[model samples]
Target: MIKFELKDLEVFYGDFQALKGIDMKIPANEITAFIGPSGCGKTTFLKCLNRMNDLVEGCRVYGQVTLDGEDIYNDYDVNLLRKRVGMVFQKPLPFKMSIYDNIAFGPRTHGIRSKSALDEIVEQSLTQATLWDEVKDRLNMDALSFSGGQQQRICIARALAVRPEVLLMDEPTSALDPISTGKIEEVVMELKKKYSIVIVTHNMQQAVRISDKTAFFLLGEVIEFGDTEKLFSVPKDKRTEEYITGRFG
Candidate 1:
């Protein structure tokens, strides 16, 4: 199933094109990784998926991007589109509230008012994010008190509570320790069973391990996209091979 269809996607920041006529289809219920060196537009392209680029002044786009066959740009309610496409950034940005409240914020904002219902969502979201067991006893404590990795997981839970159909992660584990990275990778593996996931990563091994498919980007162009095993082991593009083999990036 195609969760997102990006066709001839051209992104520009004040006349400087970042993504040049890119075309891709993100599969439903799978993890797709976009990997490339800095300035290759990997992150820029990821931001386009959720229209995060719109937040930046002078950002412009050409071509069509659809979620579940509906044009997101054509929709007047960007806020509604965002609810279906949740994003997690590199830094773990938890609100200055308790862990429980952090997870409850979205559901509450969307009209989930009952305390007991909020409690169930908080617990379920935390469990899905693999952070409940660690902080279940400290729900009322400050979320900032958690470690960097824990904070990121809390953010993930916060995103999950809204029940997004697609999750966009931009180097989600970049700031974490190895153990924390592994834990988040495990969570990513589990999440693919439910939500379609698109990740932008600088960590080659993490991309290889966690993603079902891998797309190589360079200078805002998709060099190659294929199954993870094929893309890493036997890339069709010489550029992709060089980038993977460390010959060039």
Candidate 2:
């Protein structure tokens, strides 16, 4: 099933075009990786899925972006849209609070006030992020005290706390060590069974390892988009071939 469909998508920051006309269909319950060089608009396109780009000053988007066949930019509630599409950033951004509170924050904001309910949510979210066992006994500990990898997992748990239908990760493990990166990858692999995941990564090998579908961006447009294995092995575009082979970004 298609989770998101984009046609003639374009984005501009002030007068500078950041993304040219682009088109792609993201499948449901699978990992879609956006790979490209710096400033290739991979992150820009990911933000468009949940209207995060709208937060940018002078950011303008033109074209059709639909979620579940409904135009997200047309008379949609931004807050509710965000609830359905949760985001995890490049860096671990845990609020200055305990681990339990971090996971409970989203559910609380959405009107889950019961202590028992919050308890279940916190446990489930942390478990989903694969941090439950390590932090279960210390749920009251400050989230920031954890290591970078644990902090990132906490952020993931926070995003999952809202029970989002889709998860958007922007270089989620870029700052973590290899072991940490592997853990995040493992969590993401499991998440695809329950959530449609879209990730923007500079790591081509990571893309090859996790994603079911891959989109290669260049300049301000998509050069190739298809099954992950095919796109990497038999790229239809020379630019994609060169970029993946490390000839030129």
Please give the range of 10 consecutive residues that has the lowest summed lDDT in model 1. 73-82
lDDT of each: 0.93, 0.96
lDDT of 2 by residue, 173-193 (tens): 999999999999999999999
TM-score result, candidate 1: 0.98
| Candidate 2 lDDT score at position 77 | 90
* TM-score, one value per model: 0.98, 0.99
Best by TM-score: 2
Query: Which candidate ranks first by lDDT, i.e. highest?
Result: 2
* Clashes per model (N, Cα, C within 3 A): 0, 0
